[model samples]
Target: MGVDLRRWWFDRQRLRGDLLWGVAGIVLVLAATLGGTLALTALFPGLAPVGEVGADPSPTVAADAASGLAVNLLLGWFFGFAIAAFQEETLFRGFLQNLLQERYGRLVAIVGQAGVFALAHFGYYPVSAWPLLLVVFLVGIVTGWLVDRRGTLLPAGIAHGFVG
Candidate 1:
């Protein structure tokens, strides 16, 4: 949540207290992925494999994200961080990472996990599918880079939460 975004977003957030910078990173990455994919694959090419399916956003997922944020924020210093920080950082940043890195080289492992994060977008909408996956994949790379540079997961999770 605290580092490595393009200067436009970062500079403004810096004035506000570095929180928005977290958000900026996510936005920037998503934009990058979408821009890149649209440039290379066109908009509808991935529709068959991913877009032609799915409709509703799961109530369970919505509930989890909402309740998760509520619980974590209220219980701050513990659960707030545990939910907002720990779950994403350890699970997305560490667990999925371990599995991926073991089976593939570090860069590929990171890219694969990013793809999985992107794939989760299928739960949203068909037309939104490719862009969502592309965004998340890019996000994964930035987060992994943050983790590597900071040697901590909390910051990355902060960015993820704010972006969502």
Candidate 2:
């Protein structure tokens, strides 16, 4: 089946459920990312991430940090919350995962979508930064599960905005 735009929209009737799940998703993502990184650091003391998270500033924001910080921060916040949030959830969970689910099954869909989600971060982290990728993969798995459980992208999108 093709992507159902209706399914991708937030169900106002389930706003409470979506918000609750979104909070849970946030906690899960943080736990996965932080815990995984800590565990890896313990195992490999010398492990170093290729780039620090939130280090790369957008071109417009970077152009003039002296004054753009405030404005760019607001813009960035909106961009993350409004655009990236919905876009990513719709793509990864609403579309890709459902596609995989139809052909492979729920478990495979969650895992397969998670694989793609982690790989999508290649732009930020190189192959050498496997630890971060591992953490991201775990985050993907949890978020994918959240979407599956909730049957909506709102929760994951909210979590993504917070985590982004």
Range of the 10 consecutive residues with the lowest summed lDDT in candidate 1: 4-13
Q: Which candidate has the highest TM-score of all?
A: 2
TM-score of predicted structure 1: 0.49
Error of 1 at 98 (Å): 2.8
Each candidate structure's count of clashing pairs: 2, 0
Scored by Cα lDDT, where does model 1 land? Answer: 0.58
Alpha carbon lDDT of each predicted model: 0.58, 0.82
lDDT of 1 by residue, 52-124 (tens): 4656544567658998888766666455344645565576666676567778867776776677766755565
Provide the global lDDT of candidate 2 against the true structure.
0.82
What pairs collide in candidate 1? 72-80, 118-133
Q: What is the C-alpha RMSD of each candidate to the true structure, in Å?
A: 10.1, 4.3
Q: At residue 31, give the lDDT of candidate 2.
A: 88
* TM-score to true structure, per model: 0.49, 0.80
